[model samples]
Target: MADAQRRIAELLARCDLEEAQHRLGELVFDAARQAMPRNLPELAQLAGLRKVPEMFPGATPTARIQAAIDTLSLAGGGTLVLDGRILEVTDTIQLRAGVTIDGGWGGFRAAPGFRGESVVAMRRRRIDYDAAGYARATNLLNLVIDCNRQSGVGGLCHGNAQKDRVDGLRIRNCLADGWVVDGGYELFGQNFEVIAASRRDGGVAPAPGRRGLVVAASDCHFADGVLQHFPIGLHAPGAHNHFARLHAWSTYYAADPPLLIGFLDEGEGNTFMACSADSPRLADNAAPPGRENGGYGFRSGGNAINQRLIACTVQLSQYGDAASLPPPRTIIPVHCGQVRATILGLEVRDYGSAGFGPFVTTPSPAVMRETTILGGNVHEGLPTNLQLPWSEPGRFLPRLCIAGSDAGIVQARQFGAVTRIGGLAVFELSLCLGGLRAGRGAVTIQGLPDAAAAPDEGHRIGFQPVLSHWKGGEPVVAVLHGGGRELHLLRQSTGAPVTGADLTETTAISVAGQYFTDMPGDA
Candidate 1:
């Protein structure tokens, strides 16, 4: 303990305090690393604390550990290492900046029992504005969270520090609610409720800042973890954040409500890459929207300015009703401003009953590109404002629905220039044409093998042909709209299937399909 205190004091005495703190962080991290032994029982041990489950009779070791952490925080900044027995944190453990909790070899074991609550709860409620905004001053560093908790960690992360990283964390089992920040909530009790001020109107006003992690975070990465609680996995509302190599297995909601590592607000930018989410199994009685409302894979508010979804997989485990389904809004982007989102190299399937937002309002400009919309039944049932006029004048290209999407197209009213690239086995079924306001609308198609030779079947009026793609080891079928659609199948490589639908031009039309070139052909 005296050695740790002397280290903190020496680091504080540096000329460049912040830089010194970072250097100190490296040193402390190295110490923690050296302290961890590949061989058990050789780890460091501190005095004055008893083994968790074997403490001084009635005294709770978790409480004692927490008290020690609180005291160290009040003392400014230090490290706490937990070893030996299991420490079950029944209540919230508030962590001040510059404090690192390293749970040794056995890791920190926390589970929810009796109270039926989630294990390892943090951030009891959102901090008030007058208080700290979860911001960091390089005070908190090396928060190594490695555990074997049967139930995962509950509560939004208040890690609003710049250049902070949470890595090599392993969470398994017991996932009711993953993590919620800004406007995200955990399903600790019955219903998942939003504690933000935006949700409470006619009721008792929520005490000033009584929410979750709503701080402005930057350069944070939540990587190499697994959260299996379906629906809302991890919600982040900060800027310059990255979510990589995480797996979410949700059993309650199908692909209707998607799971996410975290969500960003309008002023923030984030990227989600190389992630996977699986829906609930088909046989269970977990009735869809039996009574619940507003279920989505990912739900972003009106302020998410720029975000990207790259190389992700969202698959449904069951087949449910498409018509009598509980109006599940697939991806809800309400009144979003200037944002550039690219969803690429996606593999989606089993979800046949889903829908996208109708560009539903007048907005300035927004762009979505290189997205592969597969196996989702995008029901364009009604004409709603895509909400584009509210944005400034610019070109918006949501080049999406590359493959395996059904009825995957829409239009916004009084919108700017829009372009779409309908890839292999895609059908663009439209209702009231004005909804897809392509000021100078255009379509580009590619990668179809059937249309290159036979110009006859390319002109077929009512033939729904099945295109095959590999899934696991078996071949899966994808249906595309043929006949009546104005897509001129250029070569055998870009032919549409057969369709019973009609294609009209409410704005203006320029048809380009499947490597379709205008000159001497061979496109």
Candidate 2:
């Protein structure tokens, strides 16, 4: 094509007008012949290619792009290729199934400025659901949607029968929310960056956008994304979704509601692996009425069950001039509510003031049960590592009960060693009584920690005797009554202290029970 055009230009320059005109006609005919398919197979491949600028010349860029999209959709799904032009979209561009819009994104020249090839400067509208309320198997690749404070991408309605799914959706730079999925299923999104509008404008004021990515669907998979400057970077209230290598960060400036959270997870069976929630540049700001000023790295609540966070990190960067600024509010790294969860290899760091700990569990009437923190490190500088409502009386205490082994007894020799359940401490004890003799109608077990004692002297710690080789007259039940290192055992059935006469010299008894102690666990 270039050679033909160059030859025509040379011919016209040499004052050969007739020959130049004939050569232009021949070039046009050859171009038309190549566009027209020679065979059925060639026709099928050519039919799927629709270039926006070439197909709808003289039309507005938005109209041209939408016409190409509609034309490809009408042809039973095809690729709508943009000519690397910036399209100003003032109305919602409805997407259809089996159509892939390839907006030849040539990288952001000035990122967050929304300047680049194949960019859609959405004025106030969004690329949302079609008239049927869902668009399935629709893909978007190498596109940049400058939402201009409006929505970037929205999907299926709440009660839609068909699932709205986008496979292989890639946005290099998004000015607002990257996408919002409602009632979507099995959607795959990757390699996107969503930045808040305020950050893009270099403003200290709050960004009008709420979340970078909002997932209200199930079985969706998102990976390798950067979400920055949104109040909540990822608000996933969907179940069975997997997010990997996604990093969410807040800007230095504060928002109206305060730059609060990184990831707000209220979904069941959601897994976040190798993700990070960081507050690297949080400026001074007053929190909400009753809430704390600082933000949370990741918060899980609202009846969420079976959520797993594997090898995730939550960090708060240290301020350089700490004395100049007011102390940071309670910034909880990971806050889990009354839900069943497993946190493995979670790294939490706070280089600033000591606010809250790395792990915090809320005290509710429905206590958090079946929670496990396998291996994690809460670095120094925090006030306390594991903060739980341990003083909430019976409501929250017994929920973190520590059960014993196959014999239902944690050996008393391992008493000082902390046993954690959901990062809270619950100590179990099993004392072997063999050579110890009963004196003054009571057998005092020595070497027991003071935490093994009852809360008060009047409160007796109950115990059941596991008799292995009882000669005769072995006490079946007993209670420890003390507040010191010595645990004095008294027969519970008789309300009298166990005497040596009741037990033969060859008798063996193992006292086993669990107790709630004030000692904190290594969470």
Candidate with best TM-score: 2
Please give each candidate's TM-score.
0.44, 0.57
- Residue 405, model 1, lDDT: 32
Model 2 agreement with the true structure over 420-471: per-residue lDDT tens digits: 4432333344422212222223344443433543454444545565554443
**Candidate 2 TM-score, true structure as reference:** 0.57
Q: Write one digit per residue (lDDT tens) for candidate 1, span 407-448.
A: 344332222232223322222221222223222222322223
Clashes of each: 49, 1
lDDT on C-alpha atoms for all candidate structures = 0.34, 0.50
